[model samples]
Target: MSGSNKTDFTNPSTFILLGIPGLEASHVWISIPFCTMYAIAVLGNFTILFIVKMEPSLHGPMYYFLCMLAISDLVMSMSIVPKMLSIFWFNSREIDFNACLTQMYFIHCASAMDSGIFVAMALDRYVAICDPLRHSTILTNPVVAKIGLAVLLRSGLIALPLPFLVRQWPYCRTNIIRQPYCAHMAVVKLACADTSVSSYYGLFVLFCVMGLDVIFIIVSYIQILRDIFSLPTKDARLKTFGTCGSHLCAILAFYIPGLFSSLIYRFGQNIALHFHILIGTICLLLPTMLNPIIYGVRTKQIRDRVLRLFTHKGT
Candidate 1:
C-alpha cells in the first residue's frame, strides 16, 4: 500500500489550494463575509489616501504615516482576497509555483510594513504629545520621507529571501496547500527536504520585525502616557489623551488578532484546521477593514473632512 501510494511530483508547475478544508460545504456562504470585508477594505483605504492627498492641511507626519498604513492594507488584502474568493466561489484552486511564492512574499512584506507604520505612527504621536514644541521640526518632510523609505526597504529586503529559500527545497510530499492563500509555513511544510532552516529564518524575521516593533510601540506609548498626565489642567490631559485614541484603537485592531493568529498557527496543535484558517483569515482582513473606520470615527479632522465632502456632494 505504501509503495502504491508513492509521491510522483518533485516540483510541480502548479499547486492546489484547499480553501478551509473541513468547511468545504460552507465555501459559498463563507465567501460572502470575506467579499464584504474585502470591498470595504478597498474603499475605505482608498478614501483615506484620497482625503490625505487632496487636503493640504492634513498632510502632516501623522497623516503621512496613515497614508502608508492605508497603502499597506490595500496591498495586503489584494494579495490574498481575490484569489481566495476565486477558490471559494468559483472553485478555481490551481496556483503557479512562482505565483505562489510571489503571493507569499507580498502578504508577509505588507504585514511587516504595516507593523512598521504603526510604530512610526506611535512615534509621531509620542513626539506630538510629549514634545509639541519641536514636533514640526522633528518630523519634517525630509525626515518623514527617509523613515518611509527605510520601512519599505526593510520589509521588502527581509521578505525577499523567503521565496528563494522555499524554492531551494524540493517539494515531493504534495502540492496541495491547505489554506485559502499561500502562507510561508504552509508552503514550507510541503517540501520533502528538511525545512528547519526555513522555519528558523521565519521565526527570526517575526521576532526582529514584529517583536521589536511591539516593544518600541509599548515604550513610546508609556512615555506618551506619562507626559499626558503631567499636563497642568484636566482638560489638557483629556485633550492630549484624546489625540491618541484613534492610534491606540488602530494598533490594537492590527496587533491583537495578528499575534493571536501567528501564535495559534505555531503552537495550537489541538485546534481544528478550519478554525485555524478562519482565524488567520480574520487576522488579515479584520484590521484592513477596521483601520479606516477607526480613524474616520475617532479623528476629528478626518471625520469633519469626510462629512464635509459628502455634504458638499449632497448639496
Candidate 2:
C-alpha cells in the first residue's frame, strides 16, 4: 500500500492481526459480548436446521432455503469468529500466509453463499405469492439442490484467485493485518505488486455475483408487491405482506451494515482504525446472530417447534 513500485522479495513472514489496536486494554471486555453472540449464532442456526429436518410439515422449499441460509451463516461466522476471539482474548494474532489465504477463501465463499440463498429465498417468496399454484412445481427438491450447488460454486470459484494474486506479490510493507481477519483488500494492501488488476477483479466478482443477486431480489420484490396489492381483499394483502416481513428484515440486516461498512472502508480512510474494525465486525456478526432469531419469530412453525423441543427437553 505504500506508493512504491519496487517489490521487496523477502522471505514470507506471519501476519499479526491486532484486533482493534487502539483499545488493547479492553480486548477482554469487548470479547465478552462477542462470545455471547457467537454462541447464540451457532446454537440458533443449528436449532433452525434441526427443526427443519425433524418437522415433516416443514419439508418444503422455503424451509430448505432457510436451512441453507442458516448453514451459510454458520460457515461464515465460524470461519472468522474463533480467530477473532483468539485475537481479542488470548492475543493469538499470528497467522500464517497460507492459512490466512484459506480462511479468506472460505469467508468470501460463505458470504457469496449467504447472498445467493437470500436471492433464492426472495425468489421462493415471489413464486409463493405471485404464482401460488406453481410454487411447489417450480422449487422442487431437485431444483433446490441445484440452487445450493450453484451458490457454492459461484462463491468458491470466484474467490479462489484472490489469495493467489496476493501470494504472487511481495509483502514488504508490513505484516500487520489491521482487521481481525485476513480480508481481501487488507491483505492486498500489504502487497508490493501491481495490485490494480486484483482490485478490479474483486470488483468484477462483487458485481457479477452479489450485485446481480441484489438486482434479481429487488425485481422479485417489485413483482411481489404488485401482486399483493392487486389482490381483492385487505386480508389477502396483509397475509401476503406478513410472509415477506421476516425476509425483508433479514435482507436489511445483511446488506445495510455490510454496504455501510464497505463504503466507510472505501471512503473513510481518515477514520480511526479501531472504530472501523468495530463496525466491520458488527456487520458480519450481527447478521449471523440475528438471522436465526428473525426467522424464529417470523415463522410460527419454527417458533412452535422450538417450544416443543424445549417442552420435550423439560419432560
Candidate 3:
C-alpha cells in the first residue's frame, strides 16, 4: 500500500455521542435529577460493600453475593455516569474512541457480573432454605472463593471480545453514538464492517450466558419455594422467603428492564432509534441505583451492621 494511496484512517480519533436527540430538550431539566441519581447509586452501592466487609455476621454466602452485587453495581454506574454527567453539564458529545471502548468493557463486564451474582444469590437462598443442615458445608469459604473466581472469568470471557470487534472496524466520520453510553450492539451497528457476524455472535453469547443464568435462577427458586412450603408452619415459610425477598427484588429490577429494552429493539413496532437508546439508558441506570438499596435494606443482617457502624462512629 503506497503512503499516498493509503486511507487516512488517522483522522483525530473522536466520536460524538448524538445522545437522545428528542430528549435533548429535557437535558437541562434532567441534569439535576441525573446527578442526584448517579450520586445515590455510587454511594449506595459503596455503602453496601463497606457494610458487608465490616459486619462479621453478614460473612456468610448471602452477604457474599450481596457484596458481589454491590461491586458490580458500583462498577456499572461508574463506567457511564461520569461521561453522562459531562454530557449533561458541558453539552459536549465528544468521547474518544479509546475511552468509548474502555466504557463498553466495564459496562459489559459489570452487567455480566451482575447477572452471575444474581444466580449465585438464588443458589445461596436455595441452599439455606432447602437444605439448612448442609448449607454451611456446601457453601464453604473455599467454594465461595471458587465461585467468585468463576464469575469473574465468565464475565470477562463474554465481554472482552466485544471491544476488539468494534475496534477492528473502520468507522466513518458519523461517530455520534445515539445513547448516553457506549453499548456493544449499538456501537457495532455504526462500524463500517460486516457487523452481521459480530451481531449474530454477540446475540449468541447473550442468549447462551444470560439465558442459562436466568433459567438456573428460576429452577433454584422453584425448588426453594417448594422446600419452604413443605415446612410445618406459615411463619417458617415467610421467614425463609423473607430472607431472599430483597435479592429477588433486585433480580427483577435488573432483568425486567433489560429484557424489555431487548424485546423493544428486536420486535416492537417501528420506533425511532433514539427511543431505543432512551430505553436502554433508563434500564441500565435505574437498576444500578436500585439494586444496592433493595438488597441491602431487605437483609436485616446488613442493615443492622450498617447501623452499628454509624452508631459507633457517632460515639
- Which candidate number has the best TM-score? 1
Reference-based TM-score of each model: 0.97, 0.95, 0.92
Backbone clash total, candidate 2: 0
Q: Model 2, 56: alpha-carbon shift in Å?
A: 0.7
Ranking by TM-score: 1, 2, 3
* Ten-residue region with minimum lDDT total, candidate 2: 1-10
Q: After superposing candidate 1, which stretches have Cα over 4 Å from the reference?
A: 1-6
Model 3 residue pairs with clashes: none
lDDT of 2 by residue, 147-189 (tens): 8888878778888998888788777777778888988988888
Candidate 1 C-alpha lDDT tens digits along 158-250: 899899998888877788899999999999988888899999999998897799999999999999999988889999999889999999999
| Most accurate candidate by lDDT | 1
Superior candidate under TM-score, 1 versus 2: 1
Which regions in candidate 2 have their CA more than 4 angstroms from the true location?
1-11
